[model samples]
Target: MKAIREARGIGLRRLAEAIGIDPGYLSRIENGQQGAGNGTLHRYAEELNVPIKAITHEETPRDQE
Candidate 1:
């Protein structure tokens, strides 16, 4: 998350505005003090112009054949 945001030269305040979240919450996310749900995560990806898959890169795999 930090990497992508930094890559785009976006500040936490701008990202929060783009994602409709609070800057404090976004800061918590960046500092690893909080975690966001799927909906927020997707919105972050969209606002940051990155693939959803990239944002969810650490998602656990489902059990399947």
Candidate 2:
């Protein structure tokens, strides 16, 4: 996510503002400290001009096993 954003010449604050999220939260998401919901992921992918899969891979919850 950070890679795509940087490639697009966008700063964290700018992308977060564009997506209506807090920059610190976005940073956490980017750093993998938190997970983003589908809607937020879609927004990020759309803003980065990339497919949603590029940012996220569907996963089975460990607890489901």
Candidate 3:
């Protein structure tokens, strides 16, 4: 997520503001310390001008073995 966001030149704060999420929360999400819900994923994709799959595909299952 951070890679994609960086490639698109979207700053953390800017993306967070655009998606109505806290910068810290977004940072944690990007850092893999937190997970975002479907709605948040949609919000990120909308703000990033990418598809939801693009956002979702980047996330791995948290408890994957």
Best by TM-score: 2
Write candidate 2's Cα lDDT for 1-65 as tens digits.
88888989999999999999999999999999998888889999999999777788554576368
Ranking by TM-score: 2, 3, 1
Question: What RMSD, rounded to one decimal, does every model reach?
Answer: 2.9, 5.0, 5.3
For each of the candidates, give the backbone clash count.
Answer: 0, 0, 0
Q: List the residue pairs that clash in candidate 1.
A: none
Candidate 2 displacement at residue 14 in angstroms: 0.4
Residue pairs in clash, model 2 = none
Q: Once superposed on the true structure, which residue ranges of model 2 sit more than 4 Å away at CA?
A: 58-65
Report the candidate with higher lDDT, 1 versus 2. Answer: 2
**lDDT (0 to 1) per candidate:** 0.86, 0.89, 0.88
Pitting candidate 1 against candidate 3, the one with the higher lDDT is: 3
User: How would the candidate models be sorted by lDDT, starting from the highest?
Assistant: 2, 3, 1
